[model samples]
Target: MADFVDREAIRHCLARLARGEDRRDAGLIRAAWWPDATFDYGVYSGDFAAYLDWVVPGAEAISNTQHVLGQSYIELAGDSAKAETHVISYHRVDMGAGDRDTCIGGRYLDTMARRDGEWRIADRVMLYDWYQDWGAAIDWAEGVMGYPFTAGHFPGRARGDFSATFFAAGQ
Candidate 1:
């Protein structure tokens, strides 16, 4: 039972981190890490606060992002745990030329610890598996296959998005 609880908490933390990135919510991202946690993703390496500062703005610059998390392999030892989580991240950005869609497959190697009855990541190293640029983004205003999707049917923004409002009300 204790193992199950630990695993559940760790997985929730991972998901929360992903959602925070997609939403560009600093508070949500901060919740997933310990006060002194560290992070390294090749481009940046530093304490968690520094990482948060760098990541949130970077996310905001992008038009949109979606992180799809796959299977996670976790090894538990007392209050410390190690987890490798597979992820496929999709991003829509204007890379100098124009807006484009890109996908990156990677894994997050996380060192997690339970402190004060809360599970959070103590350190993380991101490993890249592959990357692909799918060229320019399509015109969503044209609608898909003659089916129009306007109004509330749109991608979530970094802030003031439908999902953010929905989740906020629930809390």
Candidate 2:
């Protein structure tokens, strides 16, 4: 059926993104989107290039990110399709000592374009449903990283502007 074709194409594109992100492959991730894909991740908002610029640098800082996509809703009309994918992401950050958990669950509403027999995300909107509770217990990163250090420490200078720095965050 036409519905199945649309669903497959959308799913494939989303899967490409998920896998690319998990592997920290920015090039592959970029292919999943249009040259002008808009992204809104609650706090940060930008196009695909901005997203990549911000995220690719964090690849070394970030340890792991896994995207689990649930069932999707797809609508097909000739060369275009509209889809909504429910996704849950689990992220582990390395605070120097070890890795800790950071997770997010959300839905992605996407408008896809069929160009040259390939599907690409034309317009996308991210709807966050929930995030993991990070409490006062050492915070999220501190619980994982374990190092105590501060910045801006001058032997002869008055309390410099920079201080109270920490590396490896584990309380």
User: Against the true structure, whose TM-score is highest?
Assistant: 1
Q: Please report, as a residue range, the 10-residue window in candidate 2 with the lowest summed lDDT.
A: 155-164
lDDT, residue 150, model 2: 43
| Total backbone collisions, model 1 | 0
What lDDT score goes with residue 93 in model 2? Answer: 63
lDDT tens string, model 2, 45-161?
788888788677555646556789998898888888888999998776665666566778899998898889888888878898998833222343232356533433431112321
The clash count for each model shown is: 0, 6
lDDT string for model 1 (1-171, tens) is 989989999999999999998877889899999989999998789998898887787753378889999999999999999999999999998888878999999999999999999999999999999999999987677666777767644645622478766768988
What candidate 2 gets wrong by more than 4 Å, as runs, is: 59-61, 94-98, 133-171
- Return the clash pairs for model 2, or none: 142-169, 142-170, 145-168, 145-169, 145-170, 146-168
Cα distance off (Å), candidate 2, residue 55: 2.5
Model 1, C-alpha of 140: deviation from truth (Å): 3.2
